[model samples]
Target: MTHVVTESCINCKHTDCVEVCPVDAFHEGPNFLVIDPDVCIDCIACVAECPVAAIYVDSDVPASQRQFLALNAELARDWPVIVRKREPLPDAAHWADVTGKIDHLQHP
Candidate 1:
């Protein structure tokens, strides 16, 4: 099963997970990241790399965040692939522990 990047990642935009992704399945957005289900190999390599614990196996995604499964797939189609790790957004530390920040996700 593919992994899903959840709402906890929306504003934080941490790239640690992207660096561990062997398949380069990660897609970068203006302020978030998504895993392309089509390209993911279920390696689980990126899960632990997420500082916010935002990455989860498709089956392990919590019920409250299940929407991320579809969101990841949808966004991955258009967002550019991100294969290298980069610093998180300047306000990442502030947003990392914030709950329910999905509305803050930037599509551009």
Candidate 2:
């Protein structure tokens, strides 16, 4: 199963997880990241790297965040792959522990 990048990653946009992705399954957006389901190998390498605990196996995605599974797939189709670690958003630390960030998501 593929891993999903959930709403907790919204404003934070941490890239630590991407550095551990063996398949380069991560895609970067303006303020978020997604995992290309087709490219993920289910290695689970990136999950622990997420400081916000935003990554999850598809089957284990929380019911409230299930939409992220499909969202990751959809966004990955157009976003460019991110293969290295980078600085998070300017306000990452402030957003990391905040919940219900779906409304703050920035597409593309």
Candidate 3:
């Protein structure tokens, strides 16, 4: 029942959600953030903070993006929860400068 990071988040990577996650379920991915489902506790804490509206509850994910739920949980199994997202990764600026990059980068 963990929350999922939808494709909308791919390049829209504003990290506001990371700051609010109680369990630090999120970690930086190459071009996005990944949620560690095992640590997520299904808290739904990160969803509302996302400026791009890219977070989703598993059942609420758009049908086109349903696979992200599995992807989120799978990635979280082996990696540890971040516990603190004190800073955005070095790549944040690139994401900031680009407009509509998220529309182009969504995972299939």
Better of 2 and 3 by lDDT: 2
lDDT of 2 by residue, 1-108 (tens): 889999999989899998888889999998999999999999999998999999999999999999998899999999999998899999999999999889888884
User: Candidate 3 — which residues are off by over 4 angstroms?
Assistant: 77-108
Report the poorest 10 consecutive residues by lDDT, candidate 3.
Answer: 99-108
What tens-digit string does per-residue lDDT give for candidate 3 at 26-103?
866555677876677887888888766778887889887777787777656654455454455466556555544544
Worst 10-residue lDDT window for candidate 1 reads: 99-108
Screening candidate 1 with a backbone cut-off below 3 angstroms (N, C-alpha, C), the clashing residue pairs are none
Model 1: lDDT of residue 59: 97
Whole-model lDDT per candidate: 0.93, 0.93, 0.70
TM-score for each model: 0.97, 0.97, 0.71
- Tens-digit lDDT track for model 1 on 22-41? 88999999999999999999
Q: Positional deviation of 74 in candidate 3, in angstroms?
A: 2.9
Provide the lDDT at 12 for model 1: 84
Off by over 4 Å in 1: none
